[model samples]
Target: MNSAEFRAVFRYIQALLIITQASLVLTDHREMLPPSPADINWLMHEWTPTVVRETNYSHRAIIPARNSQTRAAIAKVTTCDASAALTAQFFTEVEPAVRWLRSIYVV
Candidate 1:
C-alpha cells in the first residue's frame, strides 16, 4: 500500500486501541469490578495485533513508542477499581493519543 493508505490504517489502529481501552474502563466501572484476565486477553488477542498488521499493511506508519506504555497504564487501571488519580491519568493519556490518531484521518 501507498504511504497515505498506510498512515490511514495506522491512525485507525491507534484510534481503535484507544477506544478499546476506554471501553474497558467503562465496562469495569459499570460492573463494579476490576478487569479480569479474560478482559486483557480479549483486548490483546481480539483487538491489538490485527489492527497493527492492518495498519502496517496500509500505511507503514510506525507504531508510537508510547503505545505500549499506554496499554500498560490501561491494564493497571483495569486490574483494580480505578482511583480518581487513575481515572484522571487514563483520560490524560488517552485523549491526546486519540486526537493524534484522528488528525491523520482524511475525513
Candidate 2:
C-alpha cells in the first residue's frame, strides 16, 4: 500500500478502536511485499507510536510467517517498536492469535 493508503488505514483503525472499544487483531494472509521507504518511515516515525499510544492491545498475525524468516523478524521488530505504547505480538496461525487477543480482552 502507498503512504496515503497506509495513513488512511491508521485513521480507520483509530476509528474502529473508538467505536468498538476493543483490542485489534490484524491478520494478513497475503504474501508480503516490502514497504516503500516512505511508508516505513511513516510507520516508524508517526503511525506506530501515535495511533498506538492510546491503544491497550493490538496484535498482528502474519499468516505467512511459517514460510518467511524475514516476515518473522519484521513482526518481532514491530512488536519492539510499539512495546511502549501497547501489547503487540505476532503469530503464524490465526487461531492462537485470536486466543491471545481474547485473553487480553478478558483481562
Candidate 3:
C-alpha cells in the first residue's frame, strides 16, 4: 500500500488501542466495591488522546489532582501548538467533570 494508506491504518490501530486501554482501566476501577484513594487518583490522572478520524477531532480527558490544577494545566496545554484543539474541548466539555471528580475525591 501507499504511504497515505499505511498512515491511515496505523492511526486506526492506534485509536483502537487507546480506546481499549481506557476501557479496561475504567472497568477495573469500577469493579472495586469502594474505590480506593489510589483508584480515584488514577482515574483523574490517566488520560489518552483519541483522534476521531471521521470528524477530525482529537478527544482527551484530564483527571487532575485538584480543580485549580486542572484549569491551569488545560490553560497551559491549550496554548501550545500540539494540543490546542484537544485542550479547547477539555475546557469546554471535560473541565466540569474534572472539577466534580476533584471535589468528590478531595485528595
TM-score of 3: 0.25
Best by TM-score: 2
How high is the lDDT of residue 36 in model 3? Answer: 36
lDDT of 1 by residue, 50-95 (tens): 5434332222112222355444534553343322212222233445
Worst 10 residues of 3 by lDDT: 23-32
Flag regions of model 2 displaced more than 4 Å. 58-81
Runs in model 3 lying further than 4 Å from the true structure: 1-57, 61-66, 85-107
Report every candidate's CA lDDT: 0.38, 0.61, 0.36
Q: Of 2 and 3, which scores higher on lDDT?
A: 2
lDDT of 2: 0.61
Q: Per-residue lDDT of 7-74 in model 3, one digit per residue for the tens?
A: 45435645764555422110111111333334323223322223322233344443332345434433
Model 2: per-residue Cα lDDT over 1-107, one tens digit each: 66677668767877777677666656563465555566656666666676667654455544553335436545544755664555556566778877876766664
Q: What is the lDDT of residue 31 in candidate 1?
A: 16
Candidate 1: where are CA atoms >4 Å away? 1-33, 54-99
| Alpha-carbon RMSD, candidate 3 | 14.4
